[model samples]
Target: MTLQQWCFSYRGRLSRRDFWIWQGVWLVAMVMLFTLAGNNWLDTQMAAFCVVCLLWPASAVMVKRLHDRNKKGWWALLVILAWMLLAGNWTMFNGTWQWALGRFVPTLIFVMMLLDLGVFTGTAGENRFGSEARPVNYFGKPNYQ
Candidate 1:
């Protein structure tokens, strides 16, 4: 798996090791972007732009991680939907108890999905999405196997 394929493509599986490794990289990239931006409006905008630029790679990595679980790419949407529900309804958290359950459900969903994607190991072998991906080395050289 080359860096390009690992980051940009959605055709294969991502092992638990690669998923965590790339996730760490993603976290660092986000922190660096935001840190470099500081509090300047223009810089913040650029930092946000960089974050948006990472969206696809982030999505691809997550989707591939899901695929490794022997699940469909559509399963990835559950995470997105859960996140949207939680984030989109933040104001309602203080609105009323009636809306409390609404927030709780999505929060549960998000946490469950996070556990599923990040903690559990993928299926042992090839699945419908494709075979396991070879680990790529972005630090020194690209592994194309």
Candidate 2:
């Protein structure tokens, strides 16, 4: 699939390897943004802009990744919701109700989702999402067989 379709549409399956690579791309982009913008309102604004622009792509990727596991794409929404709810508040819990409401619960959910998306292998062969994503060998070349 094209990069636009792979990262910005939710119409197909994505293998774990592809999903992992996509995450890596975003990680590098985030590091670059942070390093370039540094500690300032510009940094925050830039981050927000990046997130807004990438949100659809991020959702599309997660949906496709979930499809590779034979699950509904809407599950991606739950993950996004969890992040939206918990990603604020830099201060780690300090004996406030926010500890339970923000830190603890979201951490548990995040760990679970991480395992679900990043650890487990996708279902083999065709599924409801689509035909299996074309498999790539160790060198990232397509395996013809």
The C-alpha lDDT values of all candidates are: 0.79, 0.76
Model 1, runs deviating above 4 Å: 89-103, 139-145
Off by over 4 Å in 2: 39-44, 87-97, 135-145
lDDT by residue (42-137, candidate 2, tens digit) is 567877798678777777878888898899987777776667668767466566766776777777777887789889988888998789875323
Candidate 2 lDDT for residue 127:
91
RMSD values for the candidates in order, in angstroms, are 3.0, 4.2
Name the lDDT of candidate 1: 0.79
Question: TM-score for each prediction?
Answer: 0.80, 0.78
Write one digit per residue (lDDT tens) for candidate 1, span 11-34.
Answer: 888888888888799989977777
